[model samples]
Target: MLHLMIAIPAFARMYNVSCKMCHVAFPKLNGFGQAFADNGYVFAGKQGEIYRNLGDDRARTFKELPLAVRFTHYVAASYDGGKAMTDFQSPWSVKFLLGGAPNERINFYAYVIFEKGLPPFFEDAWIDLHGFFGLPFSLTLGQFQISDLMFMRETRLTRSDFYIYKVGPYKITYHRGALLGTPIGDFGVVNGNGLSALNGKYYDDNPSKWFFGHLPLPADFGLFGLWGEDYDTLGNYVRLYRLGLDWRGVFESFYPFFQILVGFDNDTSNLFYGGFFGVDYAPGGDGVVSLLFNYVDAPANSPYRNERLATLALRYSHYVLTNLKVFAEGEGWLFKRSLALTLGVDFAF
Candidate 1:
């Protein structure tokens, strides 16, 4: 899903602005885009009172019921074992999104989706309230991603993934709990569990830590170190910790980023360390090219079994319109001698 997006069109329609106002590319938040989101989806200068309905004193109202839809279709090919296989996974997914800000202080967003090979369900429904008890930080009391504090998967540039999230040690999905985000840093607690058949409501976050999970600095560098007690595959609760460093930079049309982590699982003294580096380049007003390289290694007895992965991916996206995009991608595994290719279309309105 993100390092996923708002190509929802509703935001542009609501604010009477162009999509580019918030995105360097569709789904990728620009500086102003990040600001708009940080402001609880409201304009920074004012509360946007003139844009709201007048009938609400007890509850907030929207000038319009903000809504949008996103659809993805793709054709792909990949090397499996020693042969090439074709995949016609068109209409990969369809998503219905609803998001709105009633005022400057509160905002909400969620989505329902029907994905291929998956049950239709709703996900990522959360409300964000700005300024907690007159504090400078915001409190998000709902579901979000812990990895979001670092490299957000839903808002990424490539169809491939980061080493830390995909197969390394972490997971990419929804976590239910609360988060406090400030200008310089952010800290939060989450269920420490992935979504399941019951929506994982029976689970809860371990809240005893802060400066604990993910930390990114304004200097284009980041540090992460956190510990948690959770169950292993054997259904026994165990202690685990992850530590890492990351950095990124931008130079005109080029942007590059990197992340590395070392983790110990289930009280194992042996550790696994790895990371990924990637770049995004905008060579034209409506097109972006992206490249990624990832590698990770783990101990033999560790859950990761000292597994190693080395892959490279490249992608190019062209904006057919502000809310529509077409893309193609190619990926190769260095050790496995495998390759994958995809041509896809992603559109929203």
Candidate 2:
């Protein structure tokens, strides 16, 4: 369970650093590495028990305990048909994330879920209120993670063509209130929400913004809007929104990506869209080979019925030894309707 092959560079040469700093993995195929105790090995030492348990020793001073934690698990097996037909199962989802930053503006985030069939939910709780002075802004409140610019592209366990509209397609699932983000250094802007629960069910995007222009890519953009209430009856849902853009580079060695999304819900005016395109080929980075294509479109008059989804995926990650990682992902769906699949492995302690 902690073999990461040979303990991932023997714990990065006993801590000299440079396993990609924390590894994004390459070459070492089959068994990739770096879970570092699922992300709370804190920098590996658990840093004095995470600063004696979430820091903050009164006198409210300097910044030191911006606690951080992450745990993600997805065990999978799937095959299902339209309207719930065929069968095959073995499912799992476990996510626990806690974040920090006690002051200098304040910040804390959360997402706790232990799922097998449902019930545990917190997909992301929030608190971000950076002092604001113009370009540096924040005001998150509760329930998070719905910033879609293709939401980090894919490869996070498997993004099953966005699960028809669930897993991500037009994700509006996490809702509770407050939004605003602006860091504008690696890109920024995540805009507002809540007027008595999305007033319409979601996407009138009182303020939604996402931008990126660097880091493994040369383009990125996202905006999720709202004009809610129409889950199953009535009208005028009329306003829903999503705009995403992504572009990846590295042509000589191959690493392409693309994403696009559009959604509209004018009650029965219905209109939704989705897209995905992927390519990853690593030659010297260890192991990575991916290909993906996705599309979603279906929603015309609406008694709530839309179809036109397509998906294809293949993934492989390797690192036979060192910090260990071995991955596999496969998915196929065509024409119209449903079908999905997933496979997983991640260990980095």
Candidates' C-alpha lDDT: 0.72, 0.45
Model 1 per-residue lDDT tens digits across residues 153-271:
76787888876665543453466767776765666666666554453455543333222455556687887776666665566666667777888787898888888877776555546
| lDDT accuracy of residue 106 in candidate 1 | 74
What lDDT is obtained when candidate 1 is compared to the true structure? 0.72
- The residue ranges of model 1 lying beyond 4 angstroms of the native Cα positions read 1-7, 45-50, 55-58, 168-173, 199-211, 268-270
Q: What total of clashing residue pairs does each candidate reach?
A: 11, 45
Residue 318 lDDT, candidate 1, scale 0-100: 90
> Which ten-residue region of model 2 has the weakest summed lDDT?
1-10
Cα deviation of 192 in candidate 1 (Å)?
Answer: 1.8
Which structure among the candidates has the greatest TM-score?
1
Clashes of 1: 11
